[model samples]
Target: MAIHRKRFRVEEAIVGEMPSPEMIEEAAPMHSEIMAELRAIRAQMAKGTPPAPLSGSAAMAAIDASTAHELSEARTMLETYRAQIEQCEKLKVELDLIHDAIDRTKREIATLHGKSFDGGEMAKVNGELGAVVGGTEQATQQILEAAESIDQAASAMSKVQSADQQKRLADDIQERVISIFEACNFQDLTGQRISKVMGTMKFIEQHINAMMEIWGGVDAIKAHVPAHVDTRSEDDKLLNGPKLAGDVGHASQDDIDALFD
Candidate 1:
């Protein structure tokens, strides 16, 4: 039986709108690469490898098979590219959340540190600390002075200051020292606030570290951002605000002043 070549209109994907020049430029390389493969296949056909004076139905089957394979390959590429784009979008969202968290955490820490220690705020806390410390110091000195007075009275007792006189002097010293102790209650108030501040600082530090981990650990965070080292001394650190009374790390006002010198 003599076979006739089948005539069929090839189905092509229709363009709904004209592509922009930029879009065409972006697509050109992949288009050229695919065309190159199709050309190589055609070249082999011309060399008569399939010896295509193929019967008409056989020819149609060959075209269908090749078209199907190419379409399958295109679909695979499109699916892979779409998956990559989705992955990129998800990554961007995660990075943005972590970045925003870092910024917010930093602002809160700054507020805890006194809103970047704005001049007015710094002075206010400084004044509060100074007043508390000064009051405590004055109360302590009064106690010392009272003790010295008692000592002086005892020293003079050798001059036959009678038992009644010595007893009266001792009673006066006891009342004065006890009054100073009462005045030293400022420590209780200051300690509560200072402890609260310490707790806030620890919480901020932990939150900052968590943000760092989200951004991929310390090394990754460093890779993306510059690191800053605090140049403030240990004493300066303690003196940043009021410390508990007799805190060994606290710098005296004079010591802090000497830092500038």
Candidate 2:
């Protein structure tokens, strides 16, 4: 009988160890509460809520601190990116100014050459004028080369993925422009010619400002103008009358009479 009783007790212990549906149902609410608390903690963290005092090991605190540091670093990186983009935009404006200066120099050189040639004193002033022309031509070439370098640098800076590269290019372009302006000798001329060149440069500056106001920058102007359209108009074409009027296909006696009258 005692043996049978022990056997019965052993059977009861085994049955208790096996999982039961009732027991699982009884523990479901506790499991759900734990999950809800975890989700709430995550939500608070996402909303930038301050952390509560924790009883766990230092590992969790270290992870949290590292995550915050990374976030701060990311924000700094983004600010740096925005600053670089702004600097590039500013550099573009400077590059446009340089291009305008180069164009103005070219026009002034052309005007000076025209005036010197048309003055009709070539016999007396040929040597002096020739030297001036040579110097002007050299300066013009240098200005154009520098302008091209600036334009290319601006373009490269715009395309660059690195902020440091953009900064370096911008600095280089600025330095080149300054160097060109300093190296140019505009002091040899004695009177109205120098004044006229200065006037031209001023006019160029005004024109560039107007263009920037209308279109934003050099790139914007390029975007607006069709690439295939020739900007230069021939002198002969400007002087020529309309071909249709000169064709003699549709004239009347009344027109002749009116002209005579």
- Top lDDT model: 1
The C-alpha RMSD in Å for every predicted model, in order, reads 21.6, 33.8
Cα shift from native, residue 230, model 2 (Å): 33
For all candidates in order, the CA lDDT equals 0.73, 0.70
Error of 2 at 60 (Å): 99
* TM-scores of the candidates in the order shown: 0.47, 0.26
Clashing pairs in 2: none
User: What is the alpha-carbon RMSD of candidate 1 to the true structure?
Assistant: 21.6
Off by over 4 Å in 2: 1-124, 187-261
- Candidate 1: lDDT over CA atoms? 0.73
Q: 1-261 in candidate 2: lDDT tens per residue?
A: 112223356766778655455667778999999999999989989999796666677769988999999999999999999999999999999999889867765665565455443455333355455556666777778888888899999889889999899889989899879868954754445233545545545655665565465446677767777668645577544443444745654446586589988
* Clash statistics: count for each candidate: 0, 0
Query: How many angstroms is residue 53 displaced in model 1 relative to the true structure, after the best TM-score fit?
Result: 2.9
Residue 118 local lDDT, model 1: 69
- Identify the runs in model 1 with alpha carbons over 4 angstroms from their true place: 1-52, 99-103, 106-116, 161-261
Per-residue lDDT of 61 in model 1: 100
